[model samples]
Target: MTEVAKPGVLPARPHFSSGPCAKPPGYDPAKLATDVLGRSHRSKLGKARLQYSIDLMRELLNLPDTHRIGIVPGSDTGAFEMAMWTMLGARPVTTLAWESFGEGWVTDAAKQLKLDPTVIKADYGQLPDLTTVDWSNDVLFTWNGTTSGVRVPNGDWIPADREGLSFADSTSAVFAYDLPWDKIDVATFSWQKVLGGEGGHGVLILGPRAVERLETYTPAWPLPKVFRLVSKGKLAEGVFKGETINTPSMLAVEDAIFALEWGKSIGGAAGLQARSDANAAALNRIVEARSWLGHLAIDEASRSKTSVCLTVEGADEALIKKIASLLEAEHAAYDIAGYRDAPAGLRIWCGATVDVADIEALGPWLDWAYASAKVAA
Candidate 1:
């Protein structure tokens, strides 16, 4: 093997982690509004700020008025489970998993909820057959597989008139894709994904059908106060209007606002999606030129644009670790290792917050790191 020399140039910002991703360009912590800090979340100012974030989310996503958007307590996991716990037992269920997080939903369905859902799963690099899915059953799926780097090509598979609700864990796909909101009944995402906001807060979006489920059906299992969406046989309307069930970190909310404003300045959802596409394309250029690096998700159609996973030739867990370590030590990259449960590989965040130039610069650094790691091994 050639002893590749170290790359002279380095990525301007080498933070390629898939979550708690890089903050928006020009993000200055000092610039964030401080008035909301130290105020009770229940105070009028606090409630307005929260509602503003929700409004920005709705406008950016082009979400229909038929759907309700709210800030939930936990990140994506918390929001998704809230949906599953409250509305799933009311009907037949189907769960689809293609990555670690999706598998988590399956586990919850079968074990935690004991709902006996029909499970449809696929290996890391592929999607399950969408044709075989029964629309009559409430279906749960991740809109994007953050770990495996696979995403549904489109929402075409979900029928418009299906009898059951569609629940999507969409942490990494929200700002990166032009989702078919009409087809999704319940969707959850974290602030930390495409927008690169602070973590610990989740956004839950409920379509008309999801609201119907919440108001009409109560699960046989007991509901935690944190998990409760309905109060006295009615959907807790206040929650959708910024009345959170729990106190939220005002700092995180402000951080999200900064990201959202940045997103809007660029062009809202469309602009953010275009930025992510460009970043992914930049990385793909590097991958196409490299013989040793290949995408874990082979099909371009199903491949994810945000958390792009790559398979390194002849890589084992040890080698993968070394590559990640070498890259980090060189400040060429950070947190680029694949998910713990995933196969050995690299996972790069190509979200809107990441500059395309940085991704382009990452190519040589990756080559040098891989070569150095191999030599050391």
Candidate 2:
């Protein structure tokens, strides 16, 4: 094949990282000028701002009143670990892992926590058999497998009257996917994923059932202060009310507020979902037209709209890296390389914050990179 010429068009923004995704459209650092940087997070104004962020998230997610939303220390990992340590020992546990992040949680449960959890797993681009999941045991799974670009098609497989809690690591799913809240007992996400906000903060949402578990059940293991969501056999109501377990970055909180506001201004969660869907669809068109590229997800229904992973035909790891580097060097894309542990390919962020036009612009760059890579190889 002949080398393709560099395209004249370029993505308006070259950021396509799955984490710390592209900033919200029209984002300006000046928007965060009002951040309460030097003020105590517990001060009246600070507390109100924190509460506003919680309320806004609740509103955008359309969470039921029975659910409690809180800001927790650490990113999604912290929020997830907090739930695992606090709740798993109360019952037998099952974990599902399809990608690196999910595998990390499985390791935490079986190795660190020593819960001896029953783990159901799949390779990089596939989903475990949802029908085979033992729901009677406390279940932990990622709603979207960030590295694999595979997502659970829906929550239909989860029984409504199941005997155990459902803990969902939804860091890369929220804002871009519609979550069946009633089916999820505990859910966690980071600010840097779908919302394009700063990192170092995690949002934890507990359904009434999860709160009940926290109030009534204590794990067999010791609980760290940071992971303690309950006190003296009672739920830590203050935590749910924005009294963080530790000091939080007010600057990140302000950026989160800004992102949430931007989400709302663009028609809330539905609008965000639509934006991500459009971006993915735009890219899919290019992938469909090109014989050399395809989605990593084997099942179309399971494909992710947020982190769109791609595999190039007959390409090795080195070539994939070369293609990514070429695109990066040309400033046509950044951080579009696949996860190290995942199969060699490309991972593009088509989340809400990224413009569809940028994704469209990326198609030609991908073509050029692939052609250049093939010639070099």
Candidate 3:
């Protein structure tokens, strides 16, 4: 391998983590100074801020008025668990697992909940056959597989008149991809993913059908206070009206409000999606020019624009880790290693919070890192 000169420029902010991703450009901790700390979340001021966050999210996502958006206690995991616990027993379930998180859901269904769900699975870098899904059975799947970097191309496979509800774990897909709200009955996302906000909070969106399921159907399993969505045979309206099940992180709520405002300033959902698309396109160009580096997602249609996974030809896990360490040590990138269970490679976050210029700067650093790793090997 020939020695390559170190790149002169670096990404302005070297945070490329998949979760708790890079904060929005110009993010300052002091901006959250006005957070209603040490105060009751039910206080007028605190409630107003919380309501503002919900309103902003609804506006940005173009959610229908009939949908109920609630700020739940746990992050995406908590929100997803709540949905599964509350809704899965009402009908037979079909779970599609392709990666770590999706597999986790399948485990929950088959072992924990003992729902005995029909499981459809695919290996890493590929998606399960959507055509084979039984929509008559309540379906659960991740919108984008963060570990494998593959996403469902569209919602065309979901029938309009289907009897079952669709629960989508869209933690990594929101803001970066277009979600077919008409097809999704329950959707969950975390503040830390594409929004570049603080963690410890999950946003759960329930369509009218989901709400009806909650009110009309009762699960056989025990319900924790945190997981309960209906009370007295009726939907808990206060939860959707900014009244949380438990005390929330006021600081995180403020940070989420700031991120949402920033999202709106950039032209709401359309602008955020465009930014992520451009970042992925920038990196995709580099991958196309290099024969060694290829996308972990084999199908271009299923490749994720947010968590962009790449595989280096003839590279082992150690080699991939070495390349990632080289980039981090040089301050060119951070947190670019693939998920532990994923194929040996790199995973770069191309969410809206990541600038296209930074992704462009990363190309040269990756080349240098690969060469350096090869020399060391």
Q: Best TM-score goes to which candidate?
A: 1
Q: What is the C-alpha RMSD of each candidate to the true structure, in Å?
A: 0.6, 0.9, 0.9
Q: Mind giving the per-residue lDDT tens digits that candidate 2 earns over 1-377?
A: 78788999999998999998999988898978474789998999888889999999998898989899989989999999998989888888999999999999899999998989999999999998999988889999999999999999999999999989999999999999889999999999999999999989888999998988988887888888999998788898988887999999988998999999999999999999999999999989999999999999979899999999999988889998999899999899999989999999999999999998899899899989999998999
- lDDT value for candidate 1? 0.94
Please report the candidate that would top lDDT against the real structure.
1
Q: Give the alpha carbon lDDT tens digit for every residue of 1-377 in model 1.
A: 78888989998899899998998999999999999999999999999999999999999998989999989988999999999988998889999999999999999999999989999999998999989999999999999999999999999999999999999999999999999999999999999999999889889999999998888887898988999889889999999999999999999999999999999999999999999999999999999999999999999999999999999999999999999999999899999999999999999999999999899999989988899888899
Ranking by lDDT: 1, 3, 2
- Model 3, which residues run further than 4 Å from truth? 33-35
Displacement of the residue 47 alpha carbon in candidate 2, Å: 0.4
Task: Encode model 3's per-residue lDDT on 1-377: one tens digit a residue.
Answer: 88777889998888888988999998998987574888899999888888989999999898989889999989999999999999888889999999999999999999999989999999989998899998889999999999999999988999999899999999999888878899999999999988899899999999999999999999988899999999899999989989999999999998898889999999999999999999999989989989989999989999999998999988889998899899999999999999999999899999999998998888888888998899999
The count of backbone overlaps in candidate 2 is 0
In candidate 2, where is summed lDDT lowest over 10 consecutive residues? 28-37
Candidate 1 ranges with C-alpha deviation above 4 Å: none
Off by over 4 Å in 2: 33-35
